[model samples]
Target: MLTAAIVAILVTMVLALIRAFLGPTEYDRMLAANAFGTKTVLLIALAGHALSWHSFLDVALLYAMVNFIGTIAVMRFFEYGNTRDNEGSGSTP
Candidate 1:
């Protein structure tokens, strides 16, 4: 059962990678990257169980946090980091 889950996740991850590459917009690509990260965490947990690795869950959790934070950061940058509007003001501050 675990092996089957792992294979399914791997397949989904492949699809996510394709979406990341071919997505029509930045948001779509970011969403695909986030989905890929989520699947990786699931894969880690299942593989850890199947292989009897006791500490893998902790690593997976940490990876999950990092992925979430990174996605948020990128989204924020996309939303707020564009300085082109400020460039026209000619104010040096």
Candidate 2:
């Protein structure tokens, strides 16, 4: 039963990864990537239980935090249109 669940999550993660790569828009890609991350967390947790490895849970938690922060940072970057300026610029406003 646990094996089946893990397999299903893995399949969905693959689908999400495809969507992230082939999505029509930036938002769609980001959303798909987010879904992929979520599925990954689920997969890690399930596999950890199935294999009796407790450390996987901690790794999953860390991955979740990174995923959330990365999504937010990407969104902000798109919205702000590159807030970081190049150092080669000769003048500052």
**Highest lDDT, which number?**
1
What's the count of clashing pairs in each model shown?
0, 0
Residues 14-46 of candidate 2: C-alpha lDDT, one tens digit per residue: 999999999999999999999999998998898
**TM-score, one value per model:** 0.89, 0.85
Error of 1 at 9 (Å): 0.2
lDDT of 1 at 60: 99
Give the per-residue lDDT digits (tens) of candidate 1, residues 1-93: 788899999999999999999999999999999999999999999999999999999999999999999999999988987788789999996
RMSD of each: 2.8, 2.9
TM accuracy, model 2: 0.85
TM-score of 1: 0.89
Cα deviation of 89, candidate 2, in Å: 11
- Model 1: residues >4 Å from true position, as ranges? 84-93
Give me the runs in candidate 2 sitting further than 4 Å from their true place: 83-93
CA shift at 16, candidate 1, in angstroms?
0.4
Model 1 Cα RMSD, 1 decimal? 2.8
